[model samples]
Target: MKLNLKQADTEIQPQWQPIVGYPCPPEFEPSTWVKLWQQPNPYSHDEALLLCQLTEDEWVAWIPDQGETVLYRYQFFQR
Candidate 1:
């Protein structure tokens, strides 16, 4: 997955960071299945569709758990 370095710099860094390497994974294409590596809870088809529709900023603002804990951009992935 490609990361937006500028966006990352603007946000407060999360304690749990991913360790990505060379030959980075392909970008996320719009799909019915998506997953967050850190979280086991699966998103339903409708929810996944909604997620695909959201912009990066909108996704960041939308807390999947609806709690104060913030989710970083890199945590998102296609299942």
Candidate 2:
């Protein structure tokens, strides 16, 4: 479990911003159970994305790709 924040060598707080909104589609109702987490990009350990899990099956990931924040939806495997 190694995190590669280049700035982790320095101060950590100001590097990240608070995610002000949730990117839920119309079918999904917002949940009260929320925890904020920063996960390193699987492809690039040097970067990270702010993510929140909506349910056991779904989550939203926000990335600052370039100068804009891009939103992506991830779904777990269904049985």
Candidate 3:
């Protein structure tokens, strides 16, 4: 099913900071579960908001630090 970010179903918490890195291409999507880097060249990490809005085979997420949204596949992520 398709989901939109403007809807109440997608809520991001204030404590969740944006992950570090530029908006990576879909091909560069993490090969495994990746931690949300709190700082560039991170020595530590923080909880990231995995705001998923499904669109058939793809998913949408927000990156506040970059001020942009990214589309990726849910399967690319793991715990």
Clashes per prediction? 0, 0, 0
Candidate 1 C-alpha lDDT tens digits along 31-79: 3344554552444221232234355433422334542223345655555
Predicted structure with the largest lDDT when compared to the true one: 1
Reference-based TM-score, model 2: 0.21
Scored against the true structure, residue 21 in model 3 reaches a CA lDDT of 88
Residue-by-residue lDDT tens digits, candidate 2, 1-79: 9988676456556575555696544343232222223334444222323355555555554433422132333312111
**Lowest lDDT 10-mer window, candidate 1?**
44-53
TM-scores of the candidates are: 0.27, 0.21, 0.27
What's the distance in Å from true for residue 27, model 1?
A: 0.3
- TM-score, cand. 1: 0.27
Residue 41 lDDT in candidate 2: 49
Give the poorly placed runs of model 2, Cα more than 4 Å off. 1-48, 66-79
Give the alpha carbon lDDT tens digit for every residue of 1-79 in model 3: 9777574666666695556886645432322333342422234233223455455555444433442244444433433
Quantify all predictions' global Cα lDDT against the true fold.
0.43, 0.37, 0.42
